[model samples]
Target: MNDQQNLMIKVVLDNWYSSVKRSDAIFNSLTDEQLLQEAAPGRNRGAYLMGHLTAVHDAMLPLLGLGESLHPELLEPYVKNADSKTDNHTPQQLRQFWSEVNEAVASKFNALTTDEWLQKHTSVSAEDFAKEPHRNRLNVLLSRFGHLEYHRGQVAFLKEKTD
Candidate 1:
């Protein structure tokens, strides 16, 4: 990639990181009690949403060629599975997972070369990706960043209940 391309990629990553910081602020502001409470009258608890976000981010590890997911256990309860009374993890544990997963992802993301950003993701084959080049590492990051923002908004709604 040229200087211009690298700068563009940097800007996108920066924007995504800014949203992650915003989500972190939201996570930090919630007490354990608040995390177990609903954002609205009838929705998933804050704790569930937090775990869901962590699980989704963890799934992106392999998607970006950044190695395996750090928390596959989170997949069922928080990803493939929906919110229910059965979620066994505590708010504290989910918060820890959230921080560690995001930190690891950021580290790997930062370590990528310009060429790596254009490479096919882990799940996509070179032949398939050649035909559909949009399925690249940078695109994966962009998609997940949007996912982060949507859940961040959901988590933010919990403050309304408190206020």
Candidate 2:
């Protein structure tokens, strides 16, 4: 890979790593009850958010060619009700799940080539926005990161409320 591509990859990977670390640290502070508590109406609980974040990593990993797609059905759940669980698990279980997801995300990211990073992949179609011919892989990754960050904020807010 060229120096510029390598630099970009490093920047993206480093930023992602930092974000994940910060998120995990924040999540670690919450109690099991707090993680499962619903912060607002029609919103997912912390457990659901954790599941959803991992699910996104699971889904995106395959698209990046790091692993096989295990659960296509999980795509919808990740986007919609990832954090809205009917039953709750212990804090240990939640942390284990988060670890698995983080590993998967890191593994997938590590496997990417510069060309693959620049390649395009189709993302979810939104009727509300103007129809686009296609969405790139970079855009897909960015959108997932943005979504995670938004939910991370919500998780923090919920944490504060419960504290």
Q: Could you tell me every candidate's TM-score relative to the true structure?
A: 0.94, 0.76
Q: What RMSD, rounded to one decimal, does every model reach? A: 1.5, 4.8
* Predicted model with the maximum TM-score: 1
- Number of clashing residue pairs in every model? 0, 5
Worst 10 residues of 2 by lDDT: 121-130
Model 1, 1-163: lDDT tens per residue?
7999899889999999999999999889888888898877888899989989899899988777789999899988987876885547988899899999999998998999888888888888889988999999888889988998988888898664543
Q: Counting only residues 3 or more apart in sequence or on different chains, how many pairs clash (N, Cα, C under 3 Å) in candidate 1?
A: 0
Predicted candidate 2 versus true structure: per-residue lDDT over 1-163, tens digit per residue: 7999789878877777878888898788888888877757677778778777776777776665456654445456555544436754555765786787688777777877867776555344445223552354566677777877888888886666443
Error of 2 at 67 (Å): 1.4
Candidate 1 residue pairs in clash (backbone atoms < 3 Å)? none
